[model samples]
Target: MTLSFELTQSVAILGGGPGGYEAALAAAQLGAEVTLVERAGVGGSAVITDVVPSKSLIATADAAVAIAEAGDLGVQLFAKGAHGKPLKPEIAINLAAVNKRLLTLARQQSDDMRAALVEAGVRIITGHGRLDSDNAVVVSTGPGGTDFDRVEADTLVVSVGASPRQLPSAMPDGERILTWTQLYDMTALPEHLIVVGSGVTGAEFAGAYMNLGATVTLVSSRERVLPGEDPDAATVLEKVFTRGGMTVLSKSRAEKVERSGDGVVVTLTDGRTVEGSHCLMAVGSTPNTRGIGLEEAGVQMDASGHIRVNRVARTSVPNIYAAGDCTTFVPLASVASMQGRTAVFHALGDVVIPLDRRRITANIFTAPEIATVGWQEKDVAEAHINGIVHKLPLAANPRAKMMGVRDGFVKLIARQGSGTVIGGVIVAPRASELIYPIAIAVERRLTVDQVSRVFAVYPSLSGSITDAARAMHHVERADED
Candidate 1:
């Protein structure tokens, strides 16, 4: 049912990304006048450049990986040789065609999102938008950005997303040196790609490109890749990387990246150099919150320029709110959308569920994807949570064995005594999908025994989750006895 308030509220959203888009739609549905001001096309960088395109590219790479894995499962492609002998068909990726397909997909999604907002009675302004005050947004629109438009509203939502961080020592030229956004422009895959960081973004692109038939070199300043991820999951990925011919330079930091003839050379902080056809700088991102008049409008921000927001996605200012990467919350597209809706609901006097970090499900899209939710095993080890850990390898799963899957496992963390499921990590193909049920368990505070009672498909990857939960339950019973 659409909310009908006596006084129609007006919502002004700056940035048409996931956060702003959702906020605008929710506000309009609640009988509010919504205006969304966007510099980029609708759906923002998440759709047009970053998330959509990257995931699509990774999907293509995953297809390539499946073809190779298919051979291991006795599914082979063969052609008649000159002497009438069977010849194994080689797996190849036309990266140019793949890039075109993914970009087209991104554009189509952006257009669809735009259509949805329009259908919801939202007024969208295409231009650079900034806070004129807490009550108004000023947009520089039309004809070389000379024309100006102003939107005044009762509530303001800021979801202005973030940009790839660029270092002066290693600047991107959009050719040899590039950011994650510039990757879709390459017609051909990089012959040798040197990824400068080993975080989620870096590991994802590195693994994707390597699967797409590129020599990958991952440079990490830390002792291992995916420094912040579950250590066991990281170990599996690093092992897979090396096994797939990727050069992992753990404990190495790139000081500067310079174009060396046709390729690029990355000089390490310790004075060693590595050369590659292209370099991807996945260092991190900075919020697009600078010069946006946020501070002037009395909205508080952190030292890094991220807008400070409460659990309900509201800023310090009564009428102003912030969401997405620009906010001080967890930087995930899913989290951003939730924050946006919560902000609108709270402002319009509707029911709101405050955002929680433990309830969020996160995934790293690699060959064998790593997905996690709630408190981790490390949290238990550090005495943050009284939890018991249980792990089950996918190799032991009936479906995994049938599919010739040898790597990856399912790990469950439960309350030490009560057996209430608190967190989980899955390292397998499409771990993103597998992690959802665990997220539900965490959110609903389901006990391991309760989860074990639910029947999963006989021969499926998700069986591992149930299997792990049952093991945890057994452990709990043993403790009680």
Candidate 2:
């Protein structure tokens, strides 16, 4: 179907984050005039504060872990002493320098994304933007909030994103008390970081800071660190955290966090108190969908204010679409990008594939990253899917053993009778990369037997995936018999 116009169709996107940027680019490529208005620079919180900087920081932490593990791999460092007796080299992290490097990298990425958007012929407006109606956006730009730029368009996409949820009892002062975004400001590694909440964000930071040589106390209200993830993955990570000297306080909840002299004190609901130099509130985030004129424009939203969007990223209003954390879909950068592209395609009469939760890839950037896609073992147990599971420990992998890696595993889940790949979990160094093939299998609905036949790099960590698939070959054989 063609746009009902002799002239080029116009599209306006508010908030130039991953979703907005992708939407603008996609719409522009489809022969539409696109205007992208952003409060911050391009790339939004994902690049500027959240994902990029945090992952870079985790990379530094991983480097620290590598140096410590190097000794186990027969790689040793020695320092000359006064008595001529060699002393083991101390691992020290120059946190200020690391923070500076990561911030610079984040800025560079943001700049690159902005450059790409400009090169794509998308008009860029730097300002705070809000929907004026279903067909128009109003931006507050220039000095002292005194100027305004209004854009009217044929299609509208909202990707305003979300912010770290703050509680009244524990506010982020950007110093002693911190949010995930405020962590890069520290000049020194936290002496003792009390991380509240045991979800992905909390577990990641707790593990990362501990690896970086900080005394970390992880406060979890749940029974495990990653309550929502695979239990086996969480068990392995919790073990690693304990082995690395991190204090995992499961079943604990922080009632309040207050400044105590130069440090902070956290009070628990059970009348317990924990003291630390800094506290990171990783409770979760709230969507930035409030007061955005979405309701005024007849856009439907949930009680929590997340914009409701269909699988194709379309809102209740036919011409309006929403994506990213602000929407009711999965809050992931990759998912956001896909939703953006899909939204534009659906809007402009192009082919579009609705998003599937099972195809989404999620990873926790801890020491040994946990990556997952598709159906999980929990789903089978909960009767959500009829599937079988096979698990192979990384320790049994030739490369993992050779590299002195002692933790993590590859778990694959497949349909009971058909053996069709459904979901998987990978817990290993750079599991994010390793989980891609499994994702492909799930997306293609390839059976375990088919995946087992694929030649994985011999003596590699990924070999465990093939091995696990091979071990589950009996499923296919049983059906054949």
The most accurate candidate by lDDT is: 1
lDDT of each: 0.94, 0.93
Task: Give TM per candidate.
Answer: 0.98, 0.97
lDDT of 2 by residue, 1-481 (tens): 4345587889999888899989988997888999999988898998899999999999999999999989888899999899899999899999999999999999999999989988989899998888998899999897887999999999999999999999999999998999999999999999999999999999989988999999999999999999999999999999999999999998988999999999999999999999999999999999998888999999999999999999999999999999999999999999999999999999998999999998899999987899999999989999999999999888889999898889999999999988999999999999999999999999998989899889989889889989999999877744432
lDDT for model 1, on a 0 to 1 scale? 0.94
Candidate 2 positional error at 124, Å: 0.4
lDDT of 1 by residue, 359-381 (tens): 89999999899999999989999
Candidate 2 local lDDT, residue 89: 86
Model 1 misplaced regions, further than 4 Å:
474-481
